[model samples]
Target: MRILKKILIVLVIIIAIPLIVALFVQKDYAVEREIVINQPNEEVFDYVKYLKNQDNYSKWAMMDPDMKKTYKGTDGTVGFVSAWDSDNEEVGKGEQEIVKIDEGRRIDFELRFYEPFESTEPAYMTTEEVSNDQTRVAWGFSGHMDYPMNLMFLFMDFEEMIGDDLQTGLENLKSELEE
Candidate 1:
């Protein structure tokens, strides 16, 4: 009985300490990745400004190849929306609305997720002219995780989970643009 009690106490301390530490740890989580495309800024911006282009890019990083997506409003203009549903948890479900656009410079959006939990966040992609035949594209997402999600960050590294996807998607974009 005494040995069992000792084991139980040890187990509790092992699990409880991490959770307690995580609760007190406050940090901002963010991931940013950039890729240089051989295409001009206007050309790259044109590819990203439309919902249809997202559908085409989804083939690379949307996780579920078969996820169904629907678009609303004009394809290349502000107020456009792209919603998606997927059985794959990695892909889950979400919608992105183009809230702002700056010609060939940047695109800002609102991202809402439905599965795993329901939340909305801001996301953006910006492009800068590197030269006449090259452009630099940067994609970024920023948001706060509420409560349990904040706790989950203790076990899961958001940067690891999402950063590679950003890199992969950008690499694919680079290839597509170069071709």
Candidate 2:
């Protein structure tokens, strides 16, 4: 009986210590990936401006290939919104609004997820002319996870999960833009 009590206490401490440590450890999770496309900046930027074009470039990373999408307001302009719902947890349910557009340079948006968690984050894509015929496209997302989520990240690899997806999405985008 004494041995059993000792073992239980040791197991509880092993689990509880990590949870306590995680609560104090605050870190921001970010992923960035860039792809060089064999196309001009204007050509690539124009394609990404529209929510409809997301279907073409996003197939590789989409949580749900058949997820329902609806566009609100203008299609390619700032203030345009894209909302989606999917059974896949990776994609979840979210709406993105075009927060800013700099012609062929950058597009910034706000992403809000309904399921999984009720939170919003900033997401954006940028394009720069590497040369006359090639353009560099970069996509990145940054968000903060508090308390238990920060601890969850200790076991979960945010980069491995999301970074590869970003790379795949960029490759798909490159293919579409070059085509």
Task: Name the best candidate (by TM-score).
Answer: 2
lDDT of 1: 0.81
Q: Which stretches of candidate 2 lie over 4 Å from their true place?
A: 1-16, 59-62
TM-score of each: 0.84, 0.87
Question: After superposition on all CA atoms, what RMSD does each candidate show versus the true structure?
Answer: 2.8, 2.5
Q: State the lDDT of candidate 2 residue by residue for 47-145, as single tens digits.
A: 887867877777433657778788899988989999988888877788989999988999998988898678898888999999988999998888888
Assess each prediction's global lDDT (C-alpha) against the native. 0.81, 0.84
